[model samples]
Target: MPLFKRRDGGSIRDRFEFRDVLGTGAFSKVFLAECKAEPGHLVAVKCIDKKALKGKEESLENEIKVLRKLRHQNIVQLYDTYDEKGYVYLVMELVTGGELFDRIVAKGSYTEKDASHLIRQVLHAVSFMHDNGVVHRDLKPENLLYFNHEEDSKIMISDFGLSKTEDSGVMATACGTPGYVAPEVLQQKPYGKAVDIWSIGVIAYILLCGYPPFYDENDANLFAQIIKGEYEFDAPYWNEISDSAKDFISHLMCCDPDQRFTCEQALAHPWISGNTAYTKDIHGSVASHLKKSLAKRNWKKAYNAAAAIRQLQLLRISSSRAVTGNSSSNGTPPNRPFPV
Candidate 1:
């Protein structure tokens, strides 16, 4: 049989020389490796212990099945697979550009145009996958990788460990990161490609504003926020963002999947189509917001009652902004976090 069909003739240790471990999880460890036969050829080797996979074989099989059939510039390439007595190894492309926000935070100057280009590639890859009947189910910052350390390096969507390939066009699996999970996923309803759209909306929102749409220290509160499909683009954060960009996110984060935008439709959106005209200097505000948000989350325990009152003041300002505009809330409930 061809190598693609099976690499069972010899041990994977004979093929690639393993280097430092890149990452680790409950059942698998990803390591940086070099092809022994082709010196300097680096790859990521994800090794999963069979014993650890006893109950999760379905996920692994689903990942492999989907990856084997996918070939795109934005999606990470799966080079080969090998199985040993106790473990299954996946050989994949090695990416070094780092996660989505890391790169954005690294660049001294970034903008809506740059974010648009990045998301365009992701949408294209997603369009291809949906066209082929595969759903990535899990789309988050950690899963998006860059090909190299260069500022212009390409983004590759990695980590299909939770991906599923189904012909039914709808699935009932409740798996994904808590922060970026779609409303339908939390509701345990049968869903489809629209879930990926929701994830992309969250990503795009962060890209433009440097903060997650829904956030709460309490997981239950966070889930409640997501299930309501309500989030705000407050002033100072969203004031600099373009209306077209906001419109794009509005279409994706809809609570009803049937009403959400599809990949093809998103690609043709005005913000994506006219990216060249977007603001080119949005890094300062976003970076500041990220720093502030991180500091606030980390030092919450140190804040006194005065700080709590200050938070209430911020919400009041947000409310006043709502009232001054003489416009209704963006479907926000009376009890929701005052738009801040």
Candidate 2:
């Protein structure tokens, strides 16, 4: 009963006036809502259809549990949750600035320094999550959002659907976007918080170069590349990026999780903490690659890909088959179109 109650002791439906639809998923729809008690006070209300979440309830519940415990400036805040007869409602902080990469592509003068600053904030939030025993299994650019449209708007990490707690114990589940997943994950090896750090490394790589480090038309080949930790900074792209920046990525993207840089270590690296990050404008190259590589990928395509991956996982689980780096050779792109 308390979950549905607002500060004014009214039910959630009566407390907030729901507005335009913000997002839609297989089983849920997020709406922009304004608190009636404080006019103009806004929030994102995710309305989930229980009937549609028959087999997927656990994922939603897990996300709620993880979000409820996380309190950080860079992480999206989950304000409250409620369950009604046919639907469950999640009231959350409304971030209006849009996706992280969109902001970067739109900027007139993006540089390594700017990329470093953005990654620093992400590292801070992820470091907090690690300290709290939470692993955001999914840390792609799509998951990174901006708090507002201001030039100095802070980055906010959103979408905890794939997040897991350390308490869950030995995490061997093959999850996360194909391009950003860690080597250990692709190999189906037991992984920990290092996966998130690896993802950050991949994100850092893309930030400097505008395209993914590991890419292949085949999912099996892509997995193989990641499993081997084979990726290059490349010319034209890396020609302008400083060595310190590349070093920072190498540390985080190490194949050995034990050797991979922790969030703290990454945060302290010269690229992130010092002045080694180049101030030169690489916006032309970066933006060009971003548009050429990621422009065609819309939210719907990403959502569908994620759904297909989930279904594939379910089938794999049912068959009691282990998915090794080489197992998925069907040539089918699991989370293709790359970085969702």
Candidate 3:
């Protein structure tokens, strides 16, 4: 019996009105929903299967515990949690704009200036999470959400399913997105918050070039490429980017986790530090310029623009299907590293 079902064996829909399925993952499903008591207040409801969390009771508790203590502009806000018949549900804020990956796929690539603006926001958010003693572990594009449709949109790091609080100086969980995982993590070595910075480097690389730095068809080969630091930038994609931007990524992608820059230090790098125009007023502040701009636009227009971009990308993908089929084509996949 699911925790969310009624004693009479009714479904969750019998109570709350589930609007649309936002997404589905291995462990749970996310829905845009509204409660019977509050029809106008929209919310994102994540439903985790009781069976999926069966033996991981401690993990679930820890997730809630860490989320409760987090209060950062970049981190998603958890509004409430409820356990019904057999399902566990988490109510969260629903950002109007979609995943950052969607926007990045639409534009193919971003200018160094724009990339820097986005990375700064990510760095501030990660810094705040580190200060609060939480390590996100998973910081991929899929987990990043934009508040609205804007050039400098507010980015919120969501999906804390792999996050954990560390007190012993380092954590040894072999968790995180494959290409973005730090070398230490791939090697099963103990690591700290610096792992997040390493992932950020991968993200920055993708933002500038429109593809992940280390990629291979085979998982083992992919991990090897990442560990060996095998990467290159095509002239077409990187010709206009600054040397400072490249240097910053190189420093963060260092194989030795100990040598990688901390979130604070990374923020001070020339690429991020020099771009003061994009930095928020305080640490961890989302880019207000983009957020405000998005707020002023008609949402319907913004939606149409976003939809058009997606269609364009799909058409390109369809036309180049044969070329993309080659394992080494190195073509940037649509929004795989979604940039907002």
lDDT order, best first, reads: 2, 1, 3
The digit string of per-residue lDDT tens for model 1 on 179-231 reads 67787776667888898999999989888877778765534455556777658
How high a TM-score does candidate 2 get? 0.88
Best by TM-score: 2
Using lDDT as the measure, name the better of candidate 1 and candidate 2.
2
Model 3 residue 42 lDDT? 83
Give the higher-TM-score candidate: 1 or 3: 1
- Count of backbone collisions within predicted model 3: 14
Compose the digit string of candidate 2's lDDT tens values, residues 1-340.
2234445555678989999999898788999999998999999999999899788877888899999999999999998988777888999999999998888889999999999999999999999999999999989998999999999999999999999999988898878887888877766678999999999998998998887877765454555567777677666568988999989999999989999999888988989989999899999988887876665575223432244346545555311232344433322334422332
Q: TM-scores, in order shown?
A: 0.83, 0.88, 0.73
Identify the runs in model 3 with alpha carbons over 4 angstroms from their true place.
1-17, 35-39, 107-110, 150-152, 168-170, 276-340
Better of 1 and 3 by lDDT: 1
What lDDT does model 1 reach?
A: 0.77
* Model 1 ranges off by over 4 Å: 1-8, 168-170, 275-277, 292-340
